[model samples]
Target: MFSATILSVLGSVALVAGHFTITYPEMRGDSFATGASQYIYPCANVNQTAETNRTEWPLTGGSIALDLGHAWTYAFINVGLGTDYPVTNYSLTNDRPLNITGKGDLCMEKLDLPAGLTVTDGQNATIQVVTVGETGTALYNCADIIFKTSATVLSSDDCPSNSNITTATVEEVSTNETSSTNSTADATTTTTTSGAVGTTSSLATAGFVGVAAVVIGWLL
Candidate 1:
């Protein structure tokens, strides 16, 4: 019974830390609301005309929230702008997990705009999240933004302050793996992968499960 209880506790901890999703700028269409299994690009069944707006853009120094599906070792956010879909103009890369407090918490990282990066009013922009590792997957969310001058820029106070947040130190992952990007009859696909990160914890958890089973058998 004791072993089983321990196993249950560990499993619950793991589940709590895993599971992330984008919750800002409302993410394109209704598919995200239902957690549908659709690719995250081209506004996800949204019409181009309906996806563009002039008043909803994040300011140059604002932040966005990423409700994590699971704890990740590294994450990056990229921004693209164009009249067409899948704009690829600017990117902000972070080597750390962008944790606001600790591992497995919601990541509310600031979007640091690149120097001189500007977007016109009523422009279409896409924010993409690329997580690294076996659980790694690319998620794309787009928003309509108006780039105001620095003097009149609007910043988001919605992002939680990281003042008392202490982030975990994780080893760096490799960047050699290539993500698959294919254009086919069904739809366009883009895959992004980062090296194996956080796999050790998974393996250790598996080991704990095995040990717990053994202990339970002995007690029985």
Candidate 2:
């Protein structure tokens, strides 16, 4: 019975674990193609050797959007400056972590570059979006960009933000062999209300990072 229950829960998760794509600033490559895995470190299965279609991002800050696959995710934004190596150093864009509620076309109009992280005109960089859900694997996608002094982010019909969403920090707990439960990140919790009028809740345990998403009355 226990094994059957695991299979049933995992079966539902299979539909939601399709990964995500960067919409605003073009994606590096098609990470959702057949036989592609977004969990492959820095930039998924994108061919980093070849130059991608670089979007003109403002020097100060610009818009960033994601076409998400999961119902909701504990998402993180990191920026990698320069093309020095295939795996560049990625710095978190925000001090407070962001959790995006709902699965489609979520946009942030002015996502600034990391504070004190300087850049000049025509400098190359990459915007990395890492999403984690019930599966516990950190899926990643990136958008290649060129910093410009006069660049601007124009919103499109496709980049609409979701209403009735939860955008806050969902605390991540790290578990060790000795201790099974240890909370981190100031114990900040976020609540999300999604789906139709009479919504059903769900619990998503990202076991790898030990983070459990509580979407209010979530069924285990």
Question: Which candidate achieves the best lDDT against the true structure?
Answer: 2
Q: For residues 191-216, what per-residue lDDT tens digits would candidate 2 score against the true structure?
A: 33331112233334442134533222
Whole-model lDDT, candidate 1? Answer: 0.43
lDDT of 1 by residue, 104-203 (tens): 3333444567777765545556665544323333343454444444323223345442233333322232234344864332211112212111222212
The per-prediction tally of clashing pairs is 8, 0
- The superposed Cα distance between candidate 1 and the true structure at residue 31, in angstroms, equals 4.5
Q: Clash pairs of candidate 2?
A: none
